[model samples]
Target: MSSEAPDPLQHIGAALFRPLGVEGVYARTALYEDLVERLTAFISRQRDRSAEILRFPPLMSREQLEKSGYLKSFPNLLGCVCALQGTEAEIRAAAERYEEGADWTRALAPADLVLSPAACYPVYPLVARRGAVPPDGLLFDVAADCFRREPSRSLDRLQSFRMREFVRIGPPEEILAFRQHWMERAQRLAAQLALPCRLDAASDPFFGRVGQVMAVSQLQQSLKFELLIPYYAGAKPTACMSFNYHRDQFGVIWGLKDEAGATAHTGCVAFGMDRLAVALFCVHGLELARWPGSVRAALAL
Candidate 1:
């Protein structure tokens, strides 16, 4: 190996994010945690409307995931929880086989839970259970530890991550308006953070030929927009935030209706917490103390 010292930013990142054996998984440092706290606080302080704040665990019901159509779209990226199901004696036998270098994982069976693909996936079903929403509509600040099956060394894409989402369920006009309003607000937020970003029409990486058509339709309808930020030097930017106009997608799927007896429309603004953190480090340098005063003040870090 060359004797040259490592890139200073890489050195700093290594110190801050202790990567586990798995790529994109890390033990975050205290500074990272502090940054997240400040971001969350900044988001909270900027709210003009009251919202029902909800936090869900990482795991979601498999039935719900199926109902949400995620399996049809991105089946390859779905992570299902599975466990060895058998009598104690059978389980012991499987363990023994594994200890002997055999593929004992075959004994594992699907559990009822799957890792949540997005923070908002569980919210619609829960809201549907409450029956019709008021004419004024429902707004929720929901967050969750989310996961995807992607395995990459890129710091911006994680196998497991956290998402902060603001979801709205209401009439079609109101839902679309809500998304447009947040798109503007997100632009302002990026300016405040002094992070260089651009909004672009985007779509999920849907699987197969049929899924490709779906993705095309989604973009054609301008259903999704993403905020892109540079996450690494000499590399193209990555999406750190997504503003989605689901229209009546989730609302129809969950049979959610408004007080007017019309299908409720849905929209959400989702922030990729880890990706934003990485972008900050990329743009602001390794030392928060040396970052621009305005940026520090904006994040209160």
Candidate 2:
């Protein structure tokens, strides 16, 4: 019955992750894998209702991400592609040597792809190149192993995580209105799940001194709001679902124009699938039937 958000790490198991050492959760977790199955199923059902169901891997072109304004705003969180040089046999020997506690470079001969920080960044260009989307616009359902570096290792905040997003592209008003509509819908949906959630304006945790100014501008413009559910002992609450309205940002950058000969106003509803599963587990315990019927059915608990 607590209205406060749980301590970001309140639900994450300490002992469960202790064996992971310094790298910790970034490397692996059995619990996350199990929840992955549940989340994939949930997203699949929702995607079928409105999305084209495009799957994107955990990589984006470094150039594309930079053009998307990522480097300036969140340089600290980005995971860049890197490579190591050596003969093929030397590389093989290094790989084997690393297993034996010898130094082995974790870089590739040529960088493959940069790790994606969000699930939807790749969707914009895909829709753009398709050439002339339907008058109604396009919906993309995408998931990825997103990477972001945080100063803290608290369970609520992670360096690497999975994210699933539903993106909408089209006319200015239609996309803006889509975000506005879903904000309300998420509240009702939260109620059904019996999870106390709040609609609060928010922004990405920008890095460095300049980032402070950027964060201020973001809030002043009211560009984002997250439906937060408490996860840990913290009072501020964890954001579970986010409704973001990117006005002309992605459109201008990716050429996602609409029928009106205007750059599309884009929006997305992002759900922290893993965090949500954690919230439900903590708030309602592992027992599925004991929970509210609607919530149980929604997650197929």
lDDT of 2 by residue, 1-301 (tens): 9998654444455422443454325443565455557656865665537777766777898878888898888888888777766788877786887788976765455464689999998887777787765678877787787877664556566666678888888876777888898898778777767887788999878888888888888899988999888753455688988988888898888887766667777889998876776676666655556877877677676
Q: Cα deviation of 32 in candidate 2 (Å)?
A: 6.0
Model 2 residue 279 CA deviation (Å) reads 0.7
| TM-score of predicted structure 1 | 0.95
Q: Rate the local accuracy (lDDT) of all candidates.
A: 0.88, 0.74
TM-score on alpha carbons, each prediction: 0.95, 0.82
Model 1 whole-model lDDT (C-alpha atoms): 0.88
Residue by residue across 1-301, what tens digits does model 1's lDDT show? 8998555357557756987889877899997888888888888876656799999999989999999999999999999999988899999998899789999988999999999989999999999999998898889998999989999866777898999999998988888898999889998998988898889999989999998999999999999999998765666888999999988889889999977789998999999988888788888877899999898899876
